[model samples]
Target: MNAHPLAPIPDADVDAFWRDGVICLRGLFDADWIEHMRAAVEDDLAHPGPLAREYATQAGQRFLGDIGAWAVKPGLRKYVEESPAAEIAARMLRSRKVNFLYDQLFVKEPGTAAVTPWHQDGPYWPVQGDQILSIWLALDDVTVQSSGVEYIKGSHRWGREFRPIHFGGDTEAYKMLPGETLPDIDAIRREPGSGGLEIVNWDMKAGDCLLHHSMTVHGAPGNASSTQRRRAYATRWTGDDVVYAPRNGQASITIDKPTIQPGEPIDCAVFPRLWPRPQDSSLA
Candidate 1:
């Protein structure tokens, strides 16, 4: 698989990410990468790692999720260190450098009815910065009916943080962050102007990816399709300004705690530096 984007990312796309807190870049990963990721996804499903979790929504459909794949999966480790993802993240966030935070695999099987709750990623994590973002890559053809994610345009600039809603009715899962949580976005969508907000989403092919800021408020629907599965791999990247800020009752997947102190750049053995490729060739 190629280590760089197949085509150059236009300046306009970068601008849109800053303006809207999210943007979909088409065909950045080639077919080879998709094929490789598909195999990796299947392997992960068969042999899940430490952080894997299985969820069954009210409709009794299955939703599978796992995080920190690069720690155990060879294919994902190669993708994290060698792929163009890090550079793309750096360019989009306009950061001088980037680091690999973690990888998550989300699989909503055909007919799954679990609605990923509306929340901001920043509050759930143990990090702080404007440059943190996630690249969600589709491994299968995705449509609105097949669980495409929807983002509130420019919510990241609202200068507000929302408490995370634990998936599958586990309110006690995350320690609530200070401030009011998100309003009913689904309810708001039914009204005109969607409460003066523009929610955005896209139909994506296997190689397409959506990059969104960590503070962006977003959520996904269940896989309404009866045939196609909605499988996506998300990689979270941190830019130059981000720092390690551990929180109590962090909701994100567990990792061996880093030696890096609080308020310092998260460049420990777990969250390795990626953009300025390390001198150690084995890691790069």
Candidate 2:
């Protein structure tokens, strides 16, 4: 395990988040919350739901994935929007109103070569503005060799439209433009605490959460660990001033119909407000 930084989330973290578009919050969830979430994931895996899809895998090791409203499962609904995780999100977004965007579970089996493509979460989403955020909660120990998530700091500010890619394979989908260079993951891995243009991979435990902005550039490599499985629960949220935007050529199964246009309010039934943490309240 890497030595804990052990510093309060300073203005720099929030500044980095606003400037760079991503930040990591360590040990955010307690033991009970982690266990409950773990149990929920196991139950979802065992009793495969209708939404389960063979998550576009590369080799024989297939990953089970699901989407849409998580409220169907009592455990998932309670944990996704009402847990300590939500509180952290609320504080970060600095908005009293919090909503559930969606929840996804990615469990990479040992020997899986399927790689998640580098992309921003905002474009595929049907929301507008910079109020969106995603919380990636690790349910197991994640290491660089185990296909942990990699992020390009401040890449969220990079202005580019979302591009579709074929998941799990090395094809034209993973290809970059002729002159565009992919950020060096090796250099970031080597300089752990050197600072300046650093790439961060949190040596995360079961209860750690990484809060990322909508436009942050992030992707993970193939799982190389022999026996360890990487399980994650990804919860998305939005704050005030965010609206819905419809993008052409993008398809999302979670939404029934487009209620939010490119510049409309995201007050739809799908993204219902979860917590309105009152301002000046002792809780705040």
Q: Which residue pairs overlap in candidate 2's backbone?
A: 20-154, 244-261, 245-261, 245-262
Model 2 RMSD vs true structure: 5.8
Q: After superposition, how far is residue 28 of candidate 2 from its true place, in Å?
A: 1.9
- Give Cα distance to truth, residue 107, candidate 2, Å: 0.9
Residue 67 error for model 1, in Å? Answer: 1.0
Please give the range of 10 consecutive residues that has the lowest summed lDDT in model 1. Answer: 248-257
**What are the per-residue Cα lDDT tens digits for candidate 2 across 164-187?**
444544346324422134444456
Candidate 2, residue 156: CA error in Å?
A: 0.6
Question: What is candidate 2's local distance difference test score?
Answer: 0.69
> Tens-digit lDDT track for model 1 on 178-221?
64768999999989877888999999999899999999999999
The parts of candidate 2 lying over 4 Å away from their true place are 1-10, 56-59, 168-198, 253-262, 277-284
